[model samples]
Target: MSQNNDNSVLFGNGDELPSNASDNPHINQLIDGVGRRQVLAAGAALGTLAFLGSVMPGAAVAAEPAAKGLEKLHFRPRSKLPFTAIATNRLDSISVPTGYRATPFIPWGTPITGNYPAYLSDGSNSAQDQAEQLGMHHDGMHFFPIDAQRGGKKSDHGLLVLNHEYIDAPLLHPNGPTLVAGKRSSAEEVRKEINAHGVSVVEVRRGLNGEWAVLPSARNRRITGATPMQISGPARGHALLKTRYSPKGTATRGTLNNCSHGFTPWGTYLTCEENWAGYFASRDTDLPRELSRYGLRSSSRYGWDHLKGDEFERFDATRTTTTASADYRNEPNHFGWIVEIDPFAPESVPVKRTALGRFAHEGLVFAPVKSGRPVVCYSGDDSQNEYIYKYVSRDKYRPGRSNGRLLDEGTLYVARFDASGKGEWLALDIYDKKFQQACKAAGVSFADQGEVLINTRLAADVVGATKMDRPEWGAVNPDNGEVYFTLTNNSARTSVDAANPRPANAFGHIIRWRELCKDYAGRQFAWSLFMLAGPEADSIGPNGKPLTADNRLASPDGLWFDEEGRLWIQTDMSGSQLSSGPFGNNQMLVAEPRTGELKRFLVGPVGAEVTGITATPDFRTLFVNIQHPGEGSTATNLLSTWPDGPGQRPRSATVIITREDGRRLL
Candidate 1:
């Protein structure tokens, strides 16, 4: 059943009290505050009521100027500030602000070294060529400073680790691959596709007067689908991960569908894997007994199985044979986790830390870690009706400069929201008797923690975690320590319980939570509906106060906070939706969370999904990506003529946004 078709039940009235009030006196105090305010007010006031205005907490009070065009953020800004839209159809390019300039920092198939030539884009790029060159479909990225000791200053150079989600076959191959009965071209072609499916690490530096470019330094590296990466935590070496590449089952070769990303406190890069299941193609007739165990009931979408003689056949997870020991039953277990890369240490191997649990991981955000307390990381599964998760390190963090060893050991928990406005983090541990009983009762087989992490969806389902709309990127409010996450609309999610109840969620909403005692690792927390995304008229709170337009956004995907604690939100919508005129196109927004002061900061051309937002420490310069502009168009039919080229197909490119007057983005 599609997620939208599910039943909708009001979770509870928004004014309900805490579910466990007896044990928590804070609830009583909050309840009293609500009662006292009601007695004083007597009735709901409509126009510009200060009491309704204060409901959003830290929202800014000052009205923001409408976006006539790009303007400065009014704070200390970066000089040489300029903004430009990169032009492209086939080959992607970078766009910069007016005075500022941008060049090709890196491009697909640009060789790192060895005998590989630059990419021909005609399917001639080899596995070795792919290993040395940048991967296809560059998405979420971060610029890690070479020297953090410099403190909040832009580095002349740094390491850039970018994700290559998936390859567009028509663009990669000259005449398209030779498909035979819904299979791929050749073994060589299949190999090239595999090698192009991971993270690309390149050293980049700003030249004299702040021109950013890639440097062919020794630290440049590429981790592909065949690159050896260790699997850590409970799910390592389980029966599911054993592939022909690693029969011992201790490691997997690479990561795929890397969408959004995060940065660890110790300076490592975190790449998330999303929508990976579509790449493989298996036959329905070959269904194995273990097929349902790994969510592969349908044929593979990519047609990789048609390759005459290639290991791509392993994409078929359905067991044609009765026994799990035959063929490649364990191949599906390698993906859907947060992979960490140490950009500072080029020689370091990427590790899949399984303690974070597994699903369609979108991004990971670290909560502020106190010296004597456990560190916490928040993550979201990007599929409709999926769950939000947190991983708290079992060991406490030490203040002095330490590598990210704390991340290697942690307990993963999924959220369960109660009707009374409080929530609990349900632990997912194979060692726990409760977990074992739950797993058995659900008729799923799990032998250890490794198995639990491998099948986290099953475990979460058994535990009754709150299923949400498509949960996308998240950002923590630096000023107030509240966790804010975007629930992108779920076309399939129509069921409304307490948390998610709307059908055809045209635009979605942002949900926020504050931990008790301000502890990031706390298992229990308090939460509230931050803001609903739609027209301003639709955002009425329970108290009959109108929510500000800044708090009303649709399909929020990428979210980040600048150095000065300003929140940036980016949107993504399909082509048909854009053409209808209800919305212009995907755009970027800036908001002061405390006051619900939000405004459209920038808008992209047609057919683009605005994504991948990050800012320099000074908040003067911002980088955003325009993905798949004119995305639904084919060679035979075209819609948008963006980045302006001669009969060129639109290509996704990164844009640098800066103020014309040289002011910060706050």
Candidate 2:
């Protein structure tokens, strides 16, 4: 589910066996300060840290309260979630609670714009046609309600924008991918795959019969790998991003492997780029330091570079000529940033906002906004032993006045888990004294702020940020703005810390924290584990049992909080959990934050990962994505027959869940 969501991000690398990620000795390179910090956090880190940490996100540090910080947190409780718990099953169909019904909507190949050709579903759609339709492997999404007009907050009808993270080639084409001698056979196949990797925004409206349907509207648009993007923030004009196509180093084409998402206070879609490095190939006898750290290799994960033509050549970053624009060597640098797209202004070029400090970003969540206060966003670099990050905007956020401008300038910080239950946000800024000293010792000097951003992972290391166990999706509680993240397991960890209590953590746990007294942007915060996920049988010891009425889910990936203050978690079972574990299939569950009561809400079909959740503003209609059904299937030996009968193609789809009586969900 969320396991293979993105190739694990690495400050250093070692992966579960059979994975293509290369092992690197960089793990030993971590500054003693950070490693010792993690071990300390593991032991004493239990409740809110009893020290100075963060300043309020909106308030100045000097204005911080003199009293207890996070201990002062008092979140209001909401009503318990509705619906009976669903049991995990190996069945080949979407299962919902007893009173609910599910229906597929705007799945891959569905046309969102009027001029796009209707999906033939027979794999006959051309590259251009697929470009105009929804991309493949639906992931994280959000429903922006059109309140009668663009900035309006109308709940019943709105634009449903979702991410297509990856594609299922065999099902996308007539039979399977065309190959000649193990290389691509047609340029169109490569183009179609490219078109299938991006974001889609489509209008949906409730009919007179009270059913939701895709409505052709001007706002409906598709942003595929072909969409041109503008690079902004500190890393905009860096040499690492310079290419012949955008010599100024400010623009590039398309986005790749958009896994999770976020919504800004200004009404724009924040599409996160995960695992973009795998798309390019570099045959260099030696690799660029940053490129190598991100996992760019001599061969691509999918051999798109092997296709024959200049159109397909961009997929290969290997330097072919001596000149600057001759190849795509700098192409990979343009990716891996948090891309901002204005769904309302469909024609606007999406921007890759660099202030966020990119990594294999899984998902992003913003803290509650206040006028005259700086905005704060939390993101997880979904990789094994990578770090969690945050960005504090330079300017105060004005509700209606701020759209995308608030993202242009900010300070990026990596988290350090203090063993005492408290944590610190280590500034990765080039000017940070300790970080500067670390870089100096390594014989490096900051050429500019851009250099710090281009090599964000290295900067985090120099500053000593704590390594985590594959941090996935994160959420800011609506009830109190408490930040919560899913550390989705790390079997590669030969050692364990208090933050990661389990040895070779196969099943992950949910960690949450309170920003100092009302200071959502404050550097210091108090944190605690909300739930430790594992099979019910393994819920023994001080690790405590899975939450009462446990779901026993693994790799918690996608997470969202409904208007009712209910937190919904989506599970991702990678490798063995797909079949060998008691977690029968990927699932989605509902949790009561105040009580830690979790219930299994729905389970996906065989080989399908249940992800990308969003409910309409009214909370009556809920949407969930079924990704890679029959995934890892071969042309001759398929793994599943889901959403379709036996022998038919299994397409990843978005399905809507609603109560039979049309009452509110949760």
Candidate 3:
């Protein structure tokens, strides 16, 4: 997600605190360190600073000479994009290339499970009705094939798992939230909103006409904000997680603010919790580091605590009672962790894997698995001036034998990029000498591993981890094991570094790295800038030239790599900037990683962010999400009435794109 009015204030440590020298390394220093060799190898490597003029140690080097403009770089085969690059537009509907067909499907409030309740056009559906229907504001998603033994590529019939990031209260209701004397009055309204957050799993089948439809199956399920979930890993029984609902601290109720998502090798879905701190309110003057560093406000975002009952009162995380389990002070602690769900098994309870470390997780992407190697994955903290993290399992991955437990016993490391185009992954372990010394020097202490994982941000701060500009979604290249991540714009960034080069970076950039010695769990890595996203005049392309009309973009948010190794980039430009920004509306673009060439694939409707992308195993069908269309408008003054045309409310939806002829989507 991009920084906006609703979430920007909740992001901690933007410009409020000065950047320490250790946390902000100079970009010039890194550039100067490699300037001499880079100039000499300009012809060998693609003559662009975007590649840093260096290839990975074991990567295949291109022998052919480089070309100019949109021409192929000879680093990879010249496979042309199937469709023509679409032009930028501010249309109130989805726009695609000439030969592609984009169909809106599975929109918000679509019923697929349980009793299959029908959707009411007037937004008068009951809370129970919403519990059985699709949730609002779709984000990250994945498709699981029904036939598991078909090499996991049975795309004709599959189960779709998606995350409901947050709710638009004004659109969720007929006349907006009801409040009496500045307090939420209708408990049903609040319940409906709660049911609108979390994950949704439903079976879908492709018909003879090439359209997808939701099917009625027992595996279809909805995990909402009020559902029961288990807290697993080292922090499961910690004192900080003890709440009134779960006195043993082994469980928590639901997941909120689920933004981006991931999938495990053993076929499970991972939904990340982002911007959840603002959902809770604490009235206490003296706040702990967990709450203070996360920027919890005095009032909740949706005023859920204004009502009665334990479910509603838990939103107010103030220490009203003495005992830990007497009040809901620890309610806020239960969130901000990755929640894993089995979309194939509807009856299985979701588990919050805490060993990955607690913070505002954007998403996680696993490295290519080897039989004898440990499971390694990367995640980013989606907040201003935060740090990126990596998790390495203690046990080796045994293919079918490995499960979520592989994530339970592992080390969580924060990244520190240096000025020499090199980076280090500092472990947040209580036993590491570097961590111990840094914590003592910074006057910080932790009781055990649980505390260390719970206070991950503080631990990274003590170890002097590099401050990043709002790291969001991450993807790993299939051709090479290099990891790439999107550093969304940070307007409040007062410090500049090699990784985060621009101060007050409004147009974000993409960064990639290859682990040293080809070991993902290794501490060291080589880093480089992929591309700087912005207007044509302000942005730099992959070939070290100004970006053209086909490739210029801003605030790159969601990122993914397909089976064929093409990188898919999605944007989440804020509503306030859409009018004045050169980029028309939020869009999705395809990039040739080796060549640094990009082309606009699709453009979304007004006030919507193009995010949460996936593709069928055969690459013939592609699924993309359009979130919050016509956002920032009130009920009285509707800004967008898309998908349903002139008289209906704008709905966040998933779009299916296919080729005009029955062929692969590439």
lDDT of each: 0.61, 0.73, 0.81
Location of the lowest summed lDDT over 10 successive residues in candidate 2: 10-19
| Model 3 lDDT tens row, 511-537 | 877777444788988676777788877
Q: Which residue pairs does candidate 3 place in steric collision?
A: none
Q: Count the backbone clashes (under 3 Å) in each candidate.
A: 37, 20, 0
After superposing all C-alphas onto the true structure, candidate 3 shows an RMSD in angstroms of 4.4
For model 2, the superposed segments whose C-alpha errors exceed 4 Å read 1-78, 148-152, 540-544, 547-550, 634-638
The C-alpha local distance difference test score for the whole of candidate 2 amounts to 0.73
Best by lDDT: 3
Q: How accurate is candidate 3 locally (lDDT)?
A: 0.81
Sequence-dependent TM-score of model 3: 0.93
lDDT of 1 by residue, 445-553 (tens): 6667787787777678776677777778888866556677888776543334434535556677666666654456767775655555665565533223444433334
**Model 1, poorest ten-residue lDDT window?**
9-18
Residue 440 lDDT in model 3? 92
Residue 431 lDDT, candidate 2, scale 0-100? 71
